[model samples]
Target: MKNNDMLKNILVWVVVATILMTVFNHFSTQGQSATSRLDYSDFIDQVHQGQVSQVIIEGQTIRGVYGSGQSFTTYNPGDPGLMGDLLDNRVKITAKPPEQQSVLMQIFISWFPMLLLIGVWIFFMRSMGGGVGGKGGPMSFGKSKARMMTEDQNKVTLDDVAGADEAKQEVGEIVDFLKDPTKYQNLGGSIPRGVLMVGPPGTGKTLLAKAIAGEAKVPFFTISGSDFVEMFVGVGASRVRDMFEQAKAHAPCIIFIDEIDAVGRSRGSGMGGGNDEREQTLNQMLVEMDGFEGNEGIIVIAATNRADVLDPALLRPGRFDRQVTVGLPDIRGREQILKVHMRKVPLAEDVRPSYIARGTPGFSGADLANLVNEAALFAARENDKLVTQKHFEKAKDKILMGVERKSMVMKESERRMTAYHEAGHAIVGYLVPEHDPVYKVSIMPRGRALGVTMYLPEEDSYSYSKRKLESQLSSLYGGRLAEEIIYGEDAVTTGASNDIERATAIARNMVTKWGLSDNLGPLLYEEEDRGGFMGSSRNANVSGEVSKKIDEEIRNLIDRNYERARQILVDNHDKLEIMTECLMKYETIDKYQVDRIMAGEEPGAPKDWIEPDDSIPPAPEVKSSLEEASEKPKEDLIEKDMSNDEVKEPGEPKLH
Candidate 1:
């Protein structure tokens, strides 16, 4: 209580001191004014005392007295107590300088000018810092404004991005001008008004635009396709106007709109209420880009995966002059990309970039980075000093397939069946000339598969042989046959659900698309559209009689392949026994292990396998009467581009 009172007392004294000083300053100023102001009463009193002084009249000096020139007889001085007042009444008038001009009057006028200067100084300082944007003025919004990277700000020359070499050549001419504009102008060669970058996501479209900005050495204004759009009706158009205005001010600038198809899509064609907004925005962009009558130095660079949907106006000649394609790194390109990413990691001594490149067929720059990171993680887990080839192998498999799941439990009986199932696939792939070679085989669960057989075509194959296709079908049936011949047909389940679907589709396509049938008369049964109902949905005529012929041929082919699989399994009963035995023991076997078993060399089988008892009945020849399964001409196997090629680099995988 005492402390609070003492604080209150100190505050009160401070307030009193402030008020007292303010009152003293006001009184002092008043006294100064009063002393300097013209004092008629003082002059009258002086005249009353007979102190002589001549006051100026309209054009002459007057003696201030009752009868002096231009003097008033009755004059009572108004009280100017704090402002030049005197208590005298007499006739006195003055137009000339007073005889008693004081020193206070001169000093007071000199300091009054500084008082006015201080008030103006405070007002201007406050206005400059006045947070008028609800946030702040330009001073406070420094960081909020987007950074403008001129051509000189970046270091990624066109040479940095390796895969899109073709695109670089096209956009380079624009860069030439930004470097030296006079060279092109002298030759009468016009600059590209716009460049549209088209490619799948992560193909480096945006990066290419950055290169353009870097080369031109001009102001680069970058925004998204959706940036122009707003909830309001005219907002998008307004933003387009504003953006172009900014660009014109900074002429010879590059404006990059990433994913331009967002608002520039064929408007009024979409099922929405924003046609007014979209059409307005796109039209405004067109006018701004092409400029009604004047040539513009503002170059537009846009990017989109869906170039097909862009507005026709936006894609017109003057708008987006050239379209650049940034595609995925092909094999040789992938190798180069791998080389770039490889430089960042502490690679193991034996890890060759070429071998890694070969193993990672279709990796993008991002995928290569991930591969390195995965290798690093594998190394760190085992406390290895470097990223070993073994770690890379594991990483590659993990990336293509997924992490191995040894702990995913399966019954011993089920496990034996899965091993045989995968073994059949490995053996068929190895024997078939058209199919890819088996890379690895494992009974370890990954995703939903109880087992997986990994294979990759040795080279990127574009076409398949019919003989190869027939071999693959036989392999596809091997698992079921192995189950049936041993477990008496009841052992088969729905595990080959995926395999059946794929085989059926291929057979149908062979008949309908490939024209691969004898009785079907080499006629395609169906026609699928390539683009927009194959560009036109005109009627394609085919007689009903011809359709029946195709169906009969397809049935005949399926029956023939089924019979072939049964016969092979029967004759190779001994080989089947070796495979199942190995499967029961190890729960897995690679191509080398399967080959060893076929060559009569005992595989390094697991200890826990229950060996087949010697008393089991042998499998008989499938074609006991008819004979000769090998003599028939088989359809070729189709090898797909199934390299880790489709497994894109890790990022927001662009659906485009």
Candidate 2:
């Protein structure tokens, strides 16, 4: 490297010197030509006329100053009378021999520029041909772009990762194989040549791969799938070969490829047959992974969110033998991830990881890390010494619902309408059987909405039952229904546009996808998939009459839910009004206040509300309603076990 840099420097200096010499030669030639040229006859005529003042004679050249003091030059014709003529004319005469340049020096001067240009061209060509270092040049295009980190460089062990315990355990055997390959070999067991980590983005797939490398104490080679491909044909294949060769050179090393879907998409499924470069790259990778020529000690780990798009051949037993799912963390996993990120922040005594985790269901590892960082920033903005629970609450709310649009001014009438709309959603969700609890409701503008009502599930739910989905559909219609009841149907605003769309989609899916409608039977009536490289295929073919019936079923489902929501709101109209009034006063209200309003009582002040300190003025607070109501007593609230029949009557509020 040092030699190459020194050579480059020397070349630069040589070019600079050549340019300077060329400029100097040009100026010197210009100075020599300052005297105008004169014909020999003209000079002789001038001397005879006594117009020449002085002359300097060389072997065949004469330079002289005319009577007017202008300098001129002429060539001599070897006339013997020239000297006598000059003497007779009384012109000042001096004679000397002509100066001669060596043949070699003249040739060197004449051809220097061409030689310099050729030398520069050759230097650039050599540089492009990877003459300096075997990286980044066109000649090195076939070389792998994978970055290698020695065992000592990677310090991310499994302990550093908190949410992806299952992924770690899945790859643990690979680490063992790297540590003691003989143990597996003795039992006629070969380690998996490739492991594919499948997950959504930011779920710690890359982190898990690094942890595996750390655990094995082996070299880690990392690259993106897109890096192998190029505009040129066959380059991707070459890169794949080169990458595998490098991994083989560093035996027992782990190679991690992120976003493999970029190059691993199913072949022959694209519009114009397929991408040749990408397909070739995927083919080479498949061969290198588990080919006839065994790569015994190399382990290839790849991560992708779109596993469905990958070539099926790549997922076969010999290639990627195992697939580890790095899914979003559950509640417990989220709590652990929160704790991991919380370690870097100065926390107040009120900062509880478990509580934050519960509020942030379905959060990935990266999301939790960001949450912790956001909380820290919130604390820093307030000039607080420690991150408090309120900070985390603000961060979570911002992430979930988007930043508050506090500066947005709404008319009092609109604000009142928003309050009623949100209150309707909260009340319907609270009363509906099999529905998640109404976590909070607010009339304050947030993101694109003038009001928001949030729901929180007590536990992580992987699937929804028919009852739960029906309840969700009903709750979705509650807002528009509330508007219709408060103001006549024609007075309803477009604020419930999103709610109508969601509710319609749910009802349609219930009929078409979920087969929840009795008329649809236990069959799917969904439209054909319009995504993916290959052409779409309809899941089920229905006659035109059946399609009409399907639409009818969807409409019936929506109507039923809409009426259910309307009836629920009408039955609790007084409670709804009370909740809306509370929302208008507070701008936001939590589940505790919601429960009090539903029970036909005033919400009053929050139990956890504290008097502001007189000595130190309070900074602006951005606490979420959930966090504000967390301290409220919950012993008397309605229990989850309450049956739907218990509150079927109008004006009867269900109590625990």
Candidate 3:
């Protein structure tokens, strides 16, 4: 921040210095160019009267030296008679050949210092990260904000990126085409004009694009879709033209636009009325990509998480010729990503990349990178030389659930209630068939929840059966049932609100979208349009009668599952009490401990947990406002939504 302020001050000084110098130069050159200025009539009179010794001609301006050692300057009257009068007066005429000064050159010379000052200011502003956008004032509105890089100049290579090898290979072909276009052109094949990378956020789409640029050995241009649009009319189109012209000047180059959906969203569908400025920009971009003039030797690469929202014109074959799916990294890909990130960290002997990979099933490359960074942070906080598996585990939990709220004060009564609430979830999950095994349960707060009960799947499941869905619903309701059983209906707290919300959403989806209910049959009851990609709903298509039935069906699914949860708790009422007591004692416990207590065995030491070093002070825990509740814990709504393949409820697994 200090450096930025210093640079800003320096830039201000530079601009002021340049302006003063320009003014000083303008005034300083006046006495040297000509001593005095005379009207055109006075200069002609001097020339005709023979008072002028000789004339110096430069374009329309005239400078003359008199016999009195005085010099005068004026504009030519454009009269041929004046030259004849000068000749008749025996005046010496030293007419130099017209200086072939280009108008552009003259203009450049006049404004060169100002332009240089502005350029320097822009350079400093960009360095300070403000950028030369509207923030630079109105004159900079039309400028292209694209960042350019040369293959040899950029440090990011294909090797720097991991977990998306197939995406790398797909984009690598563009590099090959740029390196040797004739290899495929000779075989009557034309290179694709554009490639669109479609993926979820943090899936390394932009990283892959950068790697492609590094490997291509050609000029690369990168800009976000939002950079193209401006409040000024025609600015976006002007920038698009400028960008394409620059790409053409450096042929066989790549132009990458990240988050193209920002500008490339379906035209005329914007909230405002149609014929907006953004629509105009998109139209111009379409024209430039594959218009009447082909964008030959220029490959346009675009990336967007919401490709479903982009204009069809932008996605059509001739423009974005290929669509590459850069999905979340699988186990092997995640392991590779972890290894790549692990290179930067000092890992202990116990730190296993494969084990971490297995634990992080749906992590993207960015997530894995963050995981490695967090683990390193944890190690540093412990004052340890190397990041251990225990640090990695804590990092994963922090990333998933949130950092533990160690400083949060909990009363004895509230803590007990939290214990029973979490124990209910674990007991039902452990007893339910087809449900994922209970991984951990904790009454001590983490994130927004007062307590958490996590489930870890033994293996990744692509498809969920009806039985598994039922079991999930049953497990979701167990916390609420236990609260009612222990505290009675009047005393149940709002802590179960989020869990119920998630469970209800799942049940609703099953009836309205999934057609899981026998009454709904195999037909989707909700409004579904193939046009709305990403499975987004535009509106409900059902009538009042159908909507009523859908509501009833959802309610029935929830009620049945709620009853099943109640019965499971009722059958193991004594075990539930024991688990709650164990939770109150431990504050935090794992699935192994829960199982042991349920099996009537003494709870053992936490499974595979590394004891914290008491000599070293732990890192200060940072709280997330997203999960900090007014009374109870708030949920990480984003993580809950992202982890929809498993339980959607915010609980212990969310912290995993």
Candidate 4:
């Protein structure tokens, strides 16, 4: 972090120096042009007339010395003054005194002091930041100037990381090797000096390393890979040395470099702005990992999500010997993460881990924690004793859709359009076998959404098929179609502006990225839309004609899907009306209610809609050995026996 600050400071100085030099050069040039406006002139006549401030006489020629006070000979022009004007002013010249001070002497004398000052200024500027004058003379550019994070400041421990069981277990072995090198040597194994943690952002990669340090009871040095780069050539190499050396001094230590992709990126790829500085930093890092220094006790752990872009040398067998992958949690893992976070909050019986875990299919550890916090906040707002499952439902919706605005208002026409729009989505969601079940649908305002149809995916889906993508596009158009079907040409607007954008992009991507279009063929022409908010246009690659064709195809796709959803809603008009009526009355309802309307069954029909009485918190299924169940009789389930404090009734908050 200090290195980042120093680089910023250095940049500031360079900018300041450049600006000052430009301004100073501009004014100095202007002054010189004004002073030297005329060549050594016949201006002596003016000086002889006493109008000129000062004058110099040389070899019968004269020049004006422009300044305060008369700085010239008082003698007449034809007086043939004694050279130095007779150091004694009273003396008159007797046929031009031999060797009178020349014009050269006078000019040199006047500007010499200024010349000296300029030279000194130039020297000092070079010292401040190297340019042309300081190649190897005490000045250089672009140094690795970020401050190094010492051991004491790395406060993260393994205990702080709630999920990523497999990742933590892999990192644990590195710590074990560092703590006792002999144990590994005895097993005929050479301890790996570096371990690379690869995962999406907020996956606790850096936090894992901090825990290793904490567990080993050793120093932890932290710095970003960018901190090793600078405008200077060798400075990055120097910083690399410094970082590893510091780690070595605190041997049996862990050095965590966050966002290693910044420096460790592939060389010569020339993507996203390029230079040799990053290359040098990465090279130095490579050597430092496997150099003659033998960093046996100093383990280097770096984190980056784009492991694909990293240099091959950095990930070789001996360098970053271990690569740990951090993935999203499974259903049971999600439950465990939710429980861990719930422990910090006041939870009621209604707040079931299994329910939330089932709902949060794609959630990471961090996402689950945020869900719990958001749920707690919701319960607090309602003055409830403890957070209920419904509060989590709201929190989950908020987490997915965004916060609810109690102050939201709607016009009658707009409200009706939204009701049908949401109904359209609900109806189509249940009709489409591939799509997740609709949990709730509401025209109530929340975040950027005018209305939302909450769907809980049945399981984690790592990849999607063309069928799935097409289904998603159809699902997206449900709202707009519902609006258009009721209002005809004049659908009351409730800001489906963003929704339109989402649906449009999905159709476009199905044609472009997913190769789902029969016309375009099955090839991912455009990159997958992993993330980015301004729609899926960030990595678009196609000509205007191609883009036009894409747009046409997307429109055709949505048009067909819209009709598909409209037909479903029309066929299920009774169910749609009932769903809309429930929404109109209650404003919001859960999955069970939605199921009743769709299945045309009574509220308590199958009894499977009810929360099960025997359900308990399930064991988290992670691949790590440490995550396995104990052989001794497994501990009693946590959720089976609920104290009064654990369960909250409808309108009461249990005091802590």
Q: Return the top candidate by lDDT.
A: 2
- Please report, as a residue range, the 10-residue window in candidate 4 with the lowest summed lDDT: 625-634
lDDT of 2 by residue, 155-262 (tens): 988888887777888888999999999999999999888899999889999999998999889999999999998988789999999888999899989999999999
Query: Clashes per prediction?
Result: 11, 0, 5, 13
lDDT of each: 0.66, 0.84, 0.82, 0.69
Per-residue lDDT tens digits for candidate 4, residues 1-656, read 98996797688668667756765674473234233434323343343444454444444444344444433333234554433443333222334233566799778667655865776577567556654434333443333343444446656567777668888888778778767879889889887778888888766676677788877777777778777777776788887876676666667777788888888877877543444677877778888888776776887888998898788888888898789998777888788778778888887776689878988887877788888888888889999988888889778888887777769866544555567778877788778758888877767888867777888788877888866666776777677666555444342354567667888777877887777888768765577453446334444666788767777887888888777877876677677667766666556667787877777975332222344355786555433321121111222321223243254468977899
Which is the winner by lDDT between candidate 1 and candidate 4? 4
TM-score, model 2 to reference: 0.76
Candidate 1 lDDT over 399-418, as tens digits, reads 88787787786655566667
Query: What's the TM-score of each model vs. the native?
Result: 0.63, 0.76, 0.74, 0.64
Best by TM-score: 2
Q: Estimate the lDDT of model 3.
A: 0.82
How does residue 408 of candidate 2 score in lDDT? 96
List, residue by residue over 1-656, the lDDT tens digit for candidate 3.
99997987798778778777976785585547577889988877777767888777776777888989788888886878877877887777777776586899789778877887887777667756567565344456666778789777877888988888788888877889888999999999988888999999999988888887787778889999999988877889888998898899988888999989889988877655556779888999999998899988999999998777888888888899799999988888988899988998888899899888888877888889999999999899889999999999889888876779999987667787788799899988888889988877888788888888878777667888888988899999899888777655645789989888899888887887777899977677766564678666644666888888888988999999899999999889888878888777667787678878889888866755456668987566554422232124212221233223444566565544
Higher-scoring candidate on TM-score, 3 or 4: 3
Model 2 has an lDDT value of 0.84
In order of lDDT, best first, we have 2, 3, 4, 1
Model 1 TM-score, all chains together: 0.63
